[model samples]
Target: MPAGPLRGTIRVPGDKSISHRAVMLGALAIGETRVTGLLEGEDVMATAAAMRQMGAGAAKHADGWRIHGVGVGGLLQPAMALEMGNSGTSTRLLMGLLASHAITAAFTGDASLSRRPMGRVIEPLSRIGASFTPSPGGTLPLMMTGAPVPVPIEYRLPVASAQVKSAVLLAGLNTAGITTVIEPVATRDHSERMLRGFGAELEVEELDGERIIRVRGEADLTPQTIEVPGDPSSAAFFIVAATLIEGSDLTIENVGLNPTRAGLIDVLRQMGASIEELNAREVGGEPVADLRVRHAALSCIAVDPALAPSMIDEFPVLFVAAALAQGRTVTRGLDELRVKESDRLAVMAAALTAAGARVEETADGLIIDGTGGEPLRGTANARVKTHLDHRIAMSLAIAGLASQAGVEIDDTRPIDTSFPGFIPLIEGLRHSS
Candidate 1:
């Protein structure tokens, strides 16, 4: 932990979720799409590379990224396998983008992504006439054959997953009729928002508390200028860092405050954190704000199940916060954490326990008994296994800030997939103080 309070106004990289969509949708549109504040991380860069391989002119410019697209249904067969490079978002969503294009494409990823299940996206896409030959256990390194004249169908999401939902919706873009997805639980709406922004005819209806999203097929998308907001997920580590470190005061600027993705803020506030949303505004169809977070004494609270979809990616760091707060923090309805880049639920529990915090791992979530604001007894010799998950690597690094002996991480390479500048940013903040 630093000897003094951290004080600074910093902006993280652009929103990863939105940046992925921007690149994918930009590649599918009929004309040029200009994206400002695009995240140049490895994951998003993978999407750009795939787009270029399939006939899109995705190139960098002085301002941002400029993408000249191959219209819907116009994708060319790639010469080699599309290397996804640890991005599950890129793999799943790209599978959907190619699902109706009458092309044969093979997708592959690094070890972490190769271990994740692709069946969620594969099953729904197959229902819409796409054929796939995935690895055993339905993992990646899969070959896909798209249906030239595809038929659209209504899909009801069994789980709340934005990537799965986006895959189905993107597959429907070039089909023959209207394709509808009924989400039993809401996930991030970045795909839907970006789809509509690109001139695709899409409709959203909420009935009986379920969202029914419909998109017309054979639709042509018009390109536009987009400015992506800062990622809330990347900001989570800083928010927890400032909250736990005594006397710290920091401001995170231009963070995407999309209600669907801002659940971490709500949960932290519920735990007695001092977070103020300043300069509330909208950018590129999403809510944006500057968050002023100050160190405060926090108490534990039961996190609601419904909040899972919104804060799913933030849970790892939230677990760290729980380990430092007073009393116990209980979380449930997070089985989805088990399927991320690593088994986040189990890995987080194990890592926190090694740091001298009491954590009980459940089937769905974790039960953490906090140390009541005391410094964690982690040692420099105690290394946390990140399993190549970006969130896990970054979350544990933030934990090291307040640990007694400073935590050691097994690998930080995974951080390049999302927040490439995370370590530098943290070092700058500490050095400034």
Candidate 2:
């Protein structure tokens, strides 16, 4: 089973971040908003279901989908707990949505999501008249009481989390006055963009070095038809796989090149991976274009700490690529990885080392001494542990394509979250062999 060139025009799934926000803001807006090309992954789908639990009626239409909004400040109390399956995005953002309303809601998720700490969000949102009865350690299975005319406060994020920022902002929508949140490190701005798109009075200001986002209460939203661009994150695995596979040439179409999320592309190019941008254009305020990635001799480069937020979800795959490159790649400011779907940084370091890649793990990030563009000589039989993470599983599978010994992922089920067509898409690329 040799790695093959992936040559085709692949339309990746809808942007996960944008898709999550679209469904959520649509549910909060009044009238009908038709959303085409929504990410139907488990995470985004969980958001759709969460919206319905909160008095939002969203139904599928002929060509697009329609959501009858509950209007800002008009959400009814849900009768039962909101069950978010395997989606941290759905759970965290919904907590914020649940916070500002005068409703009591409980939220729960799968075991993987339950372990993630909710205290970061709970601490800030609780100030705005909301109260929570979270499991010990502020983990999930959270019972929330949304504040009526919630108090708007200035919150400083302990860490750089787009989810926490969006949560506070969403809760701010129901607050009586402006709610301000400051982040020293900027995360993805999808929620902020989509909020304004829905006609909310949101103001973003930079002070000192942080992004201070203030939103005026009680939004009057206009219906919108969002054309979601292809997901760049989902495209990352294929790009790395194709580039690592000798004689490979692949073109990924219509990928969202949001400045906040294109770090993976930049890093790949810096590592001497041949990636080109084509048909550059803007869609719904985000720059999008086709990506052409080709096989090339590779060398690793030390990553800038600033790029972490943009490519946070891509570190695992990037690690795989770095292991196959010519020089050492050092990464820093990645403390955020400790609490993701799995302990990504540590877990990936262990897995890469297990498969004959030299990796040094740190509290915040990793330093990988590469194999100098050599295919990893994996152990006699190594089953890469995915730890129930989609990205990790996909990355290991891609490694199999290029490693001396093909890789096996523990479970590939989670790949459906973003890239439902992953295996088949890669298999189809066999023609390029």
Query: All candidates' lDDT scores?
Result: 0.92, 0.86
On TM-score, the candidate that comes out on top is 1
Writing each residue's lDDT as its tens digit, candidate 2 over 1-433 gives 4565667677778899998888888888888888888888888888898789888877778897788888888888888888887899898888898888989999998898899999988998889889999998898899999887689899988888999999999998888788898989888998888998889999998888889999998778777888899988888988888788888888899999988899999888877889999999998877899998888877988899999999999999999898888888899999889899999998898778877789999999999988887888774565778899888888877777877877776789988876788898788787645
Q: For candidate 1, lDDT tens digit of each residue in 213-269?
A: 999989899988999999999999999999999989999999999999999999999
Best by lDDT: 1
Candidate 1's TM-score: 0.99
Name the TM-score of candidate 2.
0.97
Candidate 2: residue 175 Cα off by (Å)? 1.1
Error of 2 at 108 (Å): 0.9
